[model samples]
Target: MSYVDGYVLPVPKSNIEKYREIATKAGKIWREHGALEYRECVADDVKSGEVTSFPQAVKLKDDETVIFSYIVFESRQHRDEVNAKVMSDPRLNDMMDPKSMPFDGKRMFWGGFSPIVEL
Candidate 1:
């Protein structure tokens, strides 16, 4: 089974371009470190639900939009190895600082998952 790392964050509309630039660089680094796939997607038609939603999950504001991203690896062990290299990569040093991010790092959420099914 494949292992995945997923992320959800709210980015201010004004910072979308900056966010995209960072994501592009990070995605390249992740892939170079052995990630099979890296994708970053911005919200298009998502809406807030009464009970729960992408917007609610990230505590989105009117000036912000949700970004959903994921990185795919061959397996859990593969993911760990790739991530270890990624964290130590010099190219990502500038992006490692939370204070420099365009979004609120405090509200961002991420998790690793084992895919149940893929068809």
Candidate 2:
């Protein structure tokens, strides 16, 4: 089964373009290092639900939107290997510093998940 890493974050609407640029660069680096798929999606029709919703999960406000993304790998071992290389690659290392990140790193949440089914 394929391994996956999912991410959710809050980004300022005013910085969507800049965020997209950064994501594009990072996505390219990940792809080059062996990620099978890298995708990013911004909130389009998201709205507040009576119970809970994506916006609520990230405490999104009027000026902010959510960025949902994921990276696909052949397997957990492959993901580990690729991430190690990606982390050490000079072209990507500089972006690891939260202070220099294009988006609010503190507002980002991510996790690795074991696929239960794929069909």
Candidate 3:
């Protein structure tokens, strides 16, 4: 089964384009370093829930939208290897600064998952 790393964040509407540019560059770096797939998606049909939802997950605001992203790898070990290389890649240096990001890095959440089923 493939291992996956997923991310959810809230990006300001005014900064979506900038976020996209950064994500594109980051995605390319991840792919180049052996990520099987890299995808960044903006919220289109999501809504804030009473208890929990994509919006609530990131404490989304009126001026912001949710971003859901994921990266696939052959396995946990493979993901670690790829991420190690990605972290050391010089091309990502500019994007590594939290202060320069288009969104609130403090609110961003990410996790690794082991797929139990794929069909």
Candidate 4:
């Protein structure tokens, strides 16, 4: 089974373009380091639900929206190896700063998932 890392977060409407630019660079780096896929998606039809939903996951604000993204890896070990290289890559230096981010890092949520089932 593949390993995955998921991320959901809010980005100011005005920062969407900049966010895409950053994500593009990061995605390339991840793929080069062995990630099977690095996908990013902006909320297209998110709506509030009874308890919690994608909209609520990032505490969607009036001026901001959610970005749901994921990265697929061959396995946990591959993820660790690839990420270590991506993190150390000089090409990603500018992205390491919170101030340069298009979204609020404080509100971002992410985690690695071990695949239990996959068809």
Candidate 4 residue lDDT tens string, 1-119: 89999999999999999999999999999999999999999999989999999878778889998999999999999999999999999999999799899999988999999999999
lDDT winner between candidates 2 and 3: 3
Q: Global lDDT of each model?
A: 0.96, 0.89, 0.96, 0.94
Q: Write the residue-wise lDDT of candidate 1 on 1-93 in tens digits.
A: 899999999999999999999999999999988999999999999999999999999999999999999999999999999999999999999
Could you tell me the TM-score of candidate 1? 0.97
Q: For model 3, where is the 10-residue window of minimal lDDT?
A: 47-56
Listed in order, each prediction's TM-score against the native is: 0.97, 0.91, 0.98, 0.95
- Candidate 4 backbone collisions, by pair: none
Model 3 segments more than 4 A misplaced: none
Ranking by TM-score: 3, 1, 4, 2
The backbone clash count of each candidate, in order, is 0, 0, 0, 0
RMSD (Å) of each candidate, 1 decimal: 0.7, 1.4, 0.6, 1.0
Error of 4 at 92 (Å): 1.0
Candidate 4 regions with alpha-carbon error over 4 angstroms: none
lDDT of 1: 0.96
Instruction: Give the runs in model 2 whose Cα sits over 4 Å from its true position.
Output: none
Candidate 1 Cα misplacement greater than 4 A, ranges: none
